[model samples]
Target: MSDQLDIDYTRRNKKPRSLGDSERAKLEEFIEAIHYSARYSDNDFEYRHVQLPKQMLKVIPKEYFDGARGTLKLLWEEEWRALGITQSLGWEHYEVHEPEPHILLFKRPINYQPPTH
Candidate 1:
């Protein structure tokens, strides 16, 4: 029989699919998208890289074209700091841009900074 989500077998890991509980208690945040933009207007904007987990690179789909992009995931501060990626901006919230795909961007939360241990 299907689960509450329906047409499913067993749920792997956990529920909600946002951020799991143990992952939450351990303080982890991740976001993934095929496209992104900061605003509704303007043709384009600039962004700096906030690299994702190393495992993410493993699933890159085969390129059909020279510039074919793979998955773009946002690995927030807590997620990558222990792995020694210090440049994380720890951003959140994403919105799709029209006539665009294969990009990711976000609004840097006010005074956003990872906690120092």
Candidate 2:
């Protein structure tokens, strides 16, 4: 007989973490809300084939364009506040008459410093 032994391998990094039932239910509720919003919009929004920052993309879900747009708006507001910038702007939606859809956020720069005599 050979001296080799068979070893069973398990994934070390894939362990499942348990969440409380209430927490799980809340998560499911949020997901369902997002899904419903994604499916029932009359705006006929389409997905745009544009590359966005990975960190920015993580705030919203990939399935719905509105989610991404909303997330971007919130992020931009937060950044502006943190950077002491003051200006109000809106997002623009456009289609290239090709494939996919995209939303662009435009902001006007403002001077936050006080006027001096």
Candidate 3:
């Protein structure tokens, strides 16, 4: 794994001058979760969703989500399997780190199929 997290700042616009304290905290939480799941799961496990705390949402703008989504996906896929579990079970297993702040968990529908046209 690379020492730096891969965030797509160009997708939206110019790069963020810097991350705010709240944004940084949210990012850290996200990174840790990915690392933990990856460390514990096997190659069969797939990333089904991402749970973001509500409080973190308030602090992070939509741009952050757009920019981070791709990077997060890559991290989850690359690291989560090396650990041991068969599959990412999905958002149903997600739990908020804090109760006061509700987080948005990104879950990919199991039935999702690509368009063949």
Q: Pick the candidate with the highest lDDT.
A: 3
After superposition of all CA atoms, the RMSD between model 3 and the true structure is 12.6
Q: Model 1 segments beyond 4 Å from truth?
A: 1-87
In model 2, what lDDT does residue 61 have?
A: 31
Candidate 2, residues 52-116, lDDT tens digits: the string is 33333343333222343232222233332222222333211122122212222221212223335
Whole-model Cα lDDT of every candidate shown, in order: 0.32, 0.26, 0.33
Name the runs in model 2 displaced over 4 angstroms: 1-51, 60-76, 79-104, 109-117
| Backbone atom clashes (below 3 Å) for every candidate | 0, 2, 10
Q: Report the error of model 2 at residue 40, Å.
A: 36
Q: Worst 10-residue stretch by lDDT in candidate 1?
A: 1-10
In the range 1-117, model 1's lDDT, one tens digit per residue, is 012112111212122124345543332333342212233322232233333444433333222112323333232334333323343444431321222333323444344456678
Which pairs of residues clash in candidate 2, taking residues 3 or more apart in a chain or in different chains? Answer: 47-101, 48-101
Backbone clash pairs in model 3 (N, Cα, C under 3 Å; residues 3+ apart or in different chains), count? 10
> For candidate 1, what is the total of clashing residue pairs?
0
Runs in model 3 with CA error above 4 Å?
1-45, 65-117
Candidate RMSDs in order = 13.0, 23.8, 12.6
Error of 2 at 106 (Å): 1.9
Best by TM-score: 1
